[model samples]
Target: MIRRMTDTALSEENASLKARLAETEAALEEAVEAQRRLESIVGELQREKFAARSEKLDPEQFNLPLEDVELAQGVLEAAQERARRALKGDGATGPRAPARNRGHLPKHLPRIERVIAPESTLCPCGCGEMTRIGEDTSERLDIVPAQFRVLVTRRPRYACRRCSGAVVQAYAPEHVVPGGLPTEALIAQVIVSKFGDHLPFYRQAEIYARQGLALDRATLGSWVGRACFHLRPIVAQMRENLKAADRVFMDETRAPVLSPGRKRTKTGYFWSVVADDRGHGGTGPPVVMVHYAPGRGAAHALRFLEGYRGRFVQCDGYSAYDKLTAVERPEGAWQLVHCWTHVRRRFVKRLETDGSPIAEQILHRIADLYAVEKAVRGQPPATRLAARREHAAPIIAALRPWLEAQLSRIPRSSKLAEDIRYTLGLWPGLIRFLEDGQLELDTNPVENQIRRIALTRKNALFAGHEVGAENWAMLASLIATCKMSDVNPVDYIAQTLRSLLDGHPKSRIEALMPWQFRDPSSLAA
Candidate 1:
């Protein structure tokens, strides 16, 4: 009997230990899974930090893979919550960090204040009265939804007492669109909303419908077309002013237009030309013009630049610009200056893809050149030319031979070889900045303007027709120029349309340009 009791106790102990072992194994698996998730989060954070922004530069570079990071963070929080519950025996709450305050809102924004007062002015202790003291105030930003209102115009008519046949009355104001119901302010708002804010007409129509205004997309389209028609003369004047500059920056971006009777959209182009003398301190206002074309061809560029009297045109390494080299005009022959940014981008891509030390070295040298340019920016052209010759020329001289030697070592089919050849081929144009202070190192100004078009294209998808694309270009040019001038685009468009309808002379229309615009108050004074 003693042997039987001892064996039974040993078996019960063995079974209890096995249960504990299985529980421990499950805990271990949970901990290991948590550790794996944390490790993945760290790896992704590292990649996100080090990756190139442009996919063309490094196709492998990820653009902020936040979904995985968020998932890992959630898992970590859940595990911590479980651990807290186990330790505290339930009803335990996790502590949260207090939210940090963002900076105060701008004082320039108009504020609407509401006062909250006590139910009784008497003190809580039953004092007879409480004297007013300084009150604490807090501000919260609020917005008022846009509302549409009808503008009624009534011109009273009178007749002479003796001669009833002869009648006289006040002349009615001219409308931008004859018989159109929308006012100039409303038209300006529509244009600004579409091109400046990238809101499509269909979406804008839906928003209006929600506000109890039944505006059709076709009506909005018609309004935009008419506005562009009225604004075309202004754009034409802008182009004339842009072409008259000594140097100009030109670039192009694709704009797809929907073809009638087809489901597919045809690719169009917006050729942008920008003139800014601020870089070299010339005495001319900065302006930009975008010309729409059904195709991206050399002929479009040639036609747009037909009457341009500019000495130098800065552009990328596109062969379409090569056609401009053949033009022999009496005013002046166009000098095509290649962008250093384009050349540097080639090496930048190679560095991102292959980790080439040679590419990095080239980039360093180019950066040094840019540093010199920065120091000379806003100085006279003569000063800029002198600075480049002194600081930038020697670097270029050294870089050319190094690049050629590196090129010979690389395989003919390699990207590095292509980049080296491109730089060498455009070497003359790249160095032209040394000759004239008026020339920019790159066509970045025009490229910057093109980005706004890209945003609009991304939102609208494609223009409804070729004419619609032309209308888009016209309005965008004015809006972009207004932005550049720091003028309120809506106010400028509204006032200018009213002035144009008021029979403002075409000869004096330059006064209405964004750079030259004056407030109605100032104009009246």
Candidate 2:
């Protein structure tokens, strides 16, 4: 009996030892994993601080262990809080800080004051006639949800008593879309929501459905098409105005158009031309016009700028723009003004990628030139010209030789070498800014306008057809121009369409342009 009892006890002890061993092994595995994760987080943090900032950099460099970092941080904070609680020994909640007040609503907003009075005039103790007292006041902001309403029109005909055959009735006001259910204001809202707000038609249709309105995407698209048809003349005038400027900035961004009979999108381009002399102190108002083209070929650019009388055309080093000076036209060929920002960007990339000291030196020199430009910004052309001559010319003269010397040292295939060669090739155009004060240091202004196109592209993904792309360009041009001029796009589109339907003459269309537009209320005041 004693031998059997000893065997059973030994077996039980062995099983318990095995269970404890398994628990310890599992814990060891977890600790190893935690250590690996912490090391990964540390490495990523180091790379992020010291490595190149470009998104094009190695993907592995940015694959940070974010979740592990968060978990570790939480564990540490909890441990620290527990230690503090143990030290305190009294576990009562601490007093909280008062909440910060948000500022009051704008004074310009219309206020609808509502007064709340006591239930009875007499005091609570039943005293005779409660004395007049000051009242407490508080303001809360409120909004009335957008509601669509149908405008009912009534016209009655009257016949003369003596001559019943002759009848007369008041004529109905013309609609932007004759016999269409949408009002001018509603159409304007659709256009603004689509272009300015980047809300796609299908999404807009869904939103309307939520409001108990069963408007289809196709119907909204049709409205956009018709609106573009009517607004084409104004866009054409804007183009004329833009090209008439002595100097204009130009850029192009890709626009995808859906291919018919195929389940794919074809690449297109939106060629943006911007006129803003405010940078160099010229008196012209800023205006931007975008043209949609099936391709990014030089032919499209040439055709777009065919009647342009501008002497100086500023753009990047795209091969297409080479034809700007190569092609012949009624007006003299354009003088190409290359962007210094492009040149600076090349060196910046080289410095970031290759860690080249030479590229860093070049960037600093370019920065000096920009510093001079910054001081002269918004000054008259003559003043800017003088400032460049005084400060910028010396840097350019010094940079040319240094660039040439570095070209000989670096490998011909290297990015740094390629950048140097490009800058040398466009040396004359890059220096032209020093000669003309009206010219900007870069084509950044037009590029800024192109960003809006990118946002719309991201939301809509692609245009349905070529015509849809054209309509996109037209509406974006008007809306962007309105924003540049600080004119409210909603008000501008609604009022402009109303005036057009009211038979406003084409001769007076220039006045309808965003910069030239005037509010009737302002005139009355």
Candidate 3:
């Protein structure tokens, strides 16, 4: 009996040991899962933090007309849908819409309807008589026909009575040549076609040849080069005045060129500097300028900012800005405001490819900041500053502690963790906007300018040469600035060309700015 009782006790102990062993293994698994989740949360927080710091305010700072934004949004949605379909393997996504061929006459053109009227007059009590008026007449009053005209100038010479040798013809309005076929207006049209329309001179030559004009591309190029030369002073004035502003945005993109010493594959960089003077209730001038260089370096930007004395310059976190000192700056600029959107993009990139819980939290926080911005949008800068202080300050202040606490918990290998650490390092510069009313939350305006150039480059592929690239910078600068000011680019370019040809001085060029030229009364209404 004693032996059997001892065996039973041993069996019970073995069963208990098995149960405890299983429980311990399950607990260890749970601990590992908890660590994984914790790592994810930290990652998400860092992502949000980085994105929040990189956020830019320039693009959304201005109120775009709803019609324009809506139109762009429609295109975007359609493109997105197309992308979805393409992802499903249907076909190419967002290919350019086929050009509508309107040159052909309608297959069944409508004809004018013929009217019939009774020729007999009404019958009277005693007799019926037939009376005819003039034959029924039908005429089309609004008859618009395709009309063309050519101006023929006949310069008649008059001989002096006393001195027959002295003869004179009407001076050609200081614009036309006695024998030249191209007028100032015609030259302006060609200028618009070449620079404004991006039609290379060689291509334009073919287009003209098709119309029986027989103009050489080289000659056409020379004419355009001369036109730009004539307008150089105006461009200079625009640049000088624009850089003089207290705040500016800068962006750069590749501008391929065919350098004489280099192979055809060599390329250059086109740097775009954009500024909006309408920020202070339309009291400021809108300036968009471009500078071309063979490289992407601080020296090119340094030249552009040569005489600029401004308080704030909003730009992406290009390392070049770090090299500038108060003495080096023409304006003795104090600070470089980095963009949060850039920082956010880095974290967003990681999130899309790797699911990091920490990145998600940071995104949430950024969304919160945007929500606050949405509420205060279009308010006066002072009001916006105030709203940010009241609403956004606390959120930012609360984020610091979380960032610090989470940074300690994340592993070094995680990409999200490194992003968080980098953003935290730049905390002072990123959050500097809370102290100043003039600063923007992001560098989106400059980014918008960059995006435009990017799109153009994507379409055209590359610039023909360095000089051609420079012209691209100049023309794009003016065109984009005009667009920002809500002025039709074609109208501004045409008017400026006319005014310049009419002996308009360079100093008064500000009169051509979009916002200034736009009827102020329309703004009032």
Alpha-carbon TM-score of each model against the true structure: 0.77, 0.76, 0.66
The runs of at least 3 residues in candidate 3 whose Cα sits more than 4 Å from the true structure, single-residue gaps closed, are 1-151, 154-168, 173-220, 277-282, 326-331, 506-525
Q: Compared to the true structure, candidate 1 yields what TM-score?
A: 0.77
By the TM-score metric, which is better: model 2 or model 3? 2
Q: What's the lDDT for residue 290 in model 1? A: 86
Tens digit per residue, CA lDDT, model 1, 1-525:
999999999999999999999999999999999987677566546655565423234433453576688799999999997887899877565664543332377655677878998789988898789999897566667888888888989998889899869788899888977888899898898898999999988899999999889999889878877878778788888888887887888899999999899999999999998888888887798898888998878999998887788888899999999888888888657888999988987787678666789899999999999999999999998999999999999998898999899998989997688989999999889999888888888888898899889889999999989888888898988998888777788888988888888888999878888889866422210
Candidate 1: global Cα-lDDT? 0.85
Clashing residue pairs in candidate 1, if any?
none
- The local lDDT score (0 to 100) that residue 381 gets in candidate 1 is 89
lDDT of 3: 0.69
Q: Give the alpha carbon lDDT tens digit for every residue of 116-221 in model 3.
A: 7655566666477756657634333245552323667777989989976998888654432325556555655566555445565667677777666778976766
- How many residue pairs in model 2 have overlapping backbones? 0
- Candidate 2 Cα lDDT to native: 0.85
Model 2 vs. true fold: TM:
0.76
TM-score-better candidate, 1 vs 3: 1
lDDT of 3 at 355: 64
